[model samples]
Target: MSARARRWPLVLLLGGTLLLSGCGLFGGDEEEDPPAELLKFKPSLQLRKAWSARVGDGSEHLRLGLSPATDGTLVYAAAHDGRVAAFEAGSGKRRWAAKTRLPLSGGPATDGELVVAGSSNGEVIALRAADGKRRWVGRVSSEVLAAPAIGGGLVLVRGVDGKLTALRQDDGSEAWFVQQSVPRLSVRGTGAPVIAGNVVLAGFDNGKVAAYEMSDGTLLWETLLTPPRGRTEVDRLVDINATIRVVGEDVYVVGYHGSVALLALESGQVLWARELSSYNEFALDFLNIYVSTETSEVVALSRRNGREAWRIATLLNRDVSGPAAWKNSVVVGDFEGYLHWFNAANGELQARMRAGSKRIALAPLVVGELLVAQSEDGKLYAFSERGKR
Candidate 1:
């Protein structure tokens, strides 16, 4: 294989820093340049406090993935201590609460009528949205660390053991299951499966992209994202964060500790690859791919060719979360409890707010006119860009 082909697995897991290894001690730290002035566009996005409420008693040191889910009117979320709550999206008032004994390590995903969530102990639970009552509970062998993907009347889930299973949406029945080999050293898995057309796509630490048929669970195609490092770098197994996205025929995937690449889904061909020296997930806003680095730098790249569009350095170091797009604005939350909104056309600071809380991973979801975020400290905050208009 050529050098680019051999570097595929490493790039998928650790970015370009896979060669240096161990928290990227000897990696490159080049600063990114801001985009041209023509790309500058103002973002009228801001966070507005609607309502706030404490649901279940969450545990400390449990980096549980319990992000709030919304249906434009009500927000549904799972708690660290195994509690599911429904809230009024606008007021943040509690509507109903359903308690489960399993610690919810995964976030909640909704399918119009039913809300689904996973546990650290290989359990999948479904609840009625209106009453917050238990509908069904499905169990698997491995623990679930990622959120389930709901679409086409089915729920697609990827577990920590590198197992992908499709569950029935109505009663949590097992529709199909497929297992793949796990990497020797893997990060805490957090990538959710994304459905594109007739296939379900997921990222695994083994450095491969597996696509399965949505209806019968038949293996459609499995493409190795990269090759293993030779004996010279055996400890460097491919590790990914599970943020796989598909736009039309192109699939964009990035994992922790590796590089990011754009692949043609039709033939599993790598169109372009770039050394992104970081492990942050990417947000696609129909135009550009927005990514954040662990060293607190934000960058925007062209989706077609992996070319740098813009870059900016922030004060954040360890809390550099990824970016999300809303309207004409791109928003990101950092470990310092601050939410920053930038212009999507260009990399310019637009608005920011100190959301208050640090020991949490912050992610902003721009739904309709509401910018909803889940603080690492276990709080759901809402904001709006009304004043910017």
Candidate 2:
């Protein structure tokens, strides 16, 4: 078989294997053990449900880029069925709902005035935040798998086709497009571009992260976070599927079968790197970085250097979402629809809650003292510490 054909197992292994049916890593014939049952744990912190509302039929099986976006007062969420709803952040009451009539694949990015979403057929739709009225629609080159980001008067989108297209936020006019070479075989996700001042930072399937000038898509600098290795295409896969995280003047990013590196924001220089592989986005606090490894291990590393702080390995092979830091604890969701909280200082389990019957595929959004989570079954829930109430 050709190299590309041989890599199909790896693509499926990384993307849909765990979600659909349990498949052995690298297509092995061994039967895998089922995920471990939730261990009984003592509660150190109490979490109570504040409220929850239905968005629509959630992403279902499409794994669309539907995540809740918030702007202090309101929260926005989209369903795969093209229904977008805005809710009051405090009360969880529906503000308005808009129907784009297109298969929504990405977004709910808001600049407080306009909210943008992407369709499965490459259409970018913008709606007025005040009421769910259609503002404008633009087109990109391919399917959008990441949430659209708005900043610097431009709405930026990263398409599966390796193109980063920026549209004028006011009228949805094309501003500029930046293209990169895509590997033949890659994991099934895209890293959403992040805007820092006048620069747009984006990661590609080729394992490279590049910085571009937001004004005209001019290339500022590019660095290879992971270099493909091994003989077969499957072994050579190194997609940087995780969204880049920018803290202060440094950028933190990881790849599928690659390393996690801290890069200087202005010069794209690698400050430090450690051999680690993860596709899930990470969370950072003042002292440490929390990441969910591909094997479902949640690890904490020192922010000053890439030294290991702590790791929780009992959740391995469970398909957990990225970590999100809330208050004094770090939170993560799993395929079994449960949210697990751990103490930030030590990796000890502190609390757990079930948000839905289906998987909680994305990290819970942290809005002040409230934790907002969207389940795969279309349920949006808000939670807060029991002591706060």
Candidate 3:
């Protein structure tokens, strides 16, 4: 497609399919842009706060990807301003705090003894999990947008410049780095890679998901998620930025502006591919794949075949937070700080909770029956089921 045609289709998708809320208009200006009908949700489950804490400040316009870390007894979380806090999981009492003084954009990964995280400045730092002390710091050539994946005694890091570097877990020495081609027009890079049985699976911005032999960095298989469609300029621009999801031998990935696909781990054969957009991430239950759109709608699809199962119009026009999976439920946070719990099987709203006056950064995580959430304004909160109702 031509650039003019591509811009018009994106404009139509944004203008025709999205709105802030599913409500009736109350004024003449509001009437010009009609509101979508608000879907009524009966209260099926309750949410309670087990504990709360303030981690760090966050950016309002950009998703910072700083999710809380837990080690059964100790919880580790980072502030947008660069402070890593360790708290007792049972009491939520502050245990220790490490000073980074730089933006910690990604979440921390645990290697048992140390927790590793990357800063926007391209430095990968390790901190002692016991007392929040600095372990080692390594530098990549470009920005580190996603969290590091520690698997098979190798620390896998992806740089914004489209390089996947494998580092030795014990030392910060480089094991291997593969330079992959990046999408020409992408604003961000790929998400965290996943460790399959013997492969380190990663998705790239150029619509290819490749699995490499973790030990030797040899390319085992590479699968295209959004293969060229229409054979035009815009078709060549189609990109995939899904965080690789590995379940058994099947790898699940979503395209940012293209499609959601399931690929075979061994053969790199695409099992099923469907249109779905998730700039952030997706939540997967055993059988269902929950994806959120830039239009603020949550669409559920069959994980096996990529069939549409259900859709919930969140009606939120702003970019949506990611979806988190909790047993039979899927919970998503919005930019307005509202937390929504939906039926994972059908996309039905079950409960809603408010984190604070500010916006939540990403999807709320379910840790030991409690939902942990953080706001952009530097407040961390917890939610749980009220009781068996």
Candidate 4:
């Protein structure tokens, strides 16, 4: 593959292809962009492991959207073996676990009342957040490759068929549906819809971002982050498979072979756009935004105008997870299950910790005080930093 062809999952965006063959997007041969060798560095910060637990047989080599999420107190996570569990945010105590018995892929979204997760077979399983009892099961159009969004009396799920289906919170029933046209080639997973005040924002595989009314699924506005190019479909891919972030009144989204642009919340208008290609979600704070590029370069940009603050290519081709910002530090995991923390002010490597040897495919979730990560083999870990090294 040429430099222009170095994009994400080149598989045909079929309904079920992503479930089994997503490893193609995450791996390559020795000749094509070999994994970058890691450089040894002294630890400057003490990132002690808070806790670790087995999340059950996890996604394995598949590229699933299962990640950890938290509601202020309890942390929730799901796995491919139909296991969804809740843990105490601080102590890592096993609160509850629900076995839905579906090939679960996306989510375990929580709002303290209900914990919801999606399946690779288009099933949305909702459970009681208190006891992990199964509440309701709803079906979507196709495979759910992303986490469902929970808010506003509705649970929003984006299926691989390009449909965004909204289910009633109390009972799992379809309330409204809106869908976009899929491209010939797309990445494996889809980004979860984000719920703000009255609007829910999401990006699609069609290289566009749209906003819809959370009340009745009305289309608010749509903006294309970038237009696809090149004679080959590989070069023209602009899938926004990574979840978009909404900060106050601004929305930030990045895609494969597309521009990472800041958009106005009310209207899907692009405020500032920059040419940076990525398929992973980002870590955002009051000061700066951090993203892991397609080749695994961690770059920090200004939240105001998308200006480059600093970047480090030491982890290139390591298949780094998306960055997580906590306590003025940026955290990311690599294919080798090593968690690296960097100084937010500059791109200096401060500390590193190995969770295991499995690949960490998703971004670490910063829940209150602890930073949580999940490995491909279904292991969950929590880390917290201290002043002493």
Q: Backbone clashes per model, in order? A: 16, 0, 3, 0
Q: What TM-score goes with each of the models?
A: 0.83, 0.93, 0.85, 0.94
Q: Whole-model Cα lDDT per candidate?
A: 0.70, 0.84, 0.71, 0.85
Ranking by TM-score: 4, 2, 3, 1
Error of 2 at 138 (Å): 0.7
List model 1 lDDT by residue over 98-195, tens digit each. 88887787868886588888998889998888988898999766667667888887888888778889988877889888878876455545578889
Best by TM-score: 4
User: Tens-digit lDDT track for model 2 on 268-307?
Assistant: 9999998898878789999998998877889999888989
Better of 1 and 3 by lDDT: 3
List ranges where model 4 is wrong by over 4 Å. Answer: 1-12, 15-30, 386-389
* Candidate 1 Cα errors over 4 Å, as ranges: 1-47, 230-235, 360-362
Clashing residue pairs in candidate 2, if any? Answer: none
> Whole-model lDDT, candidate 3?
0.71
Give the distance in Å from residue 21's predicted Cα in candidate 2 to where it truly belongs: 7.9
Model 4 is weakest, by summed lDDT over 10 consecutive residues, at 1-10
Candidate 3 lDDT over residue span 300-347, tens digit each: 889978899999875445345678898689887765677888888777
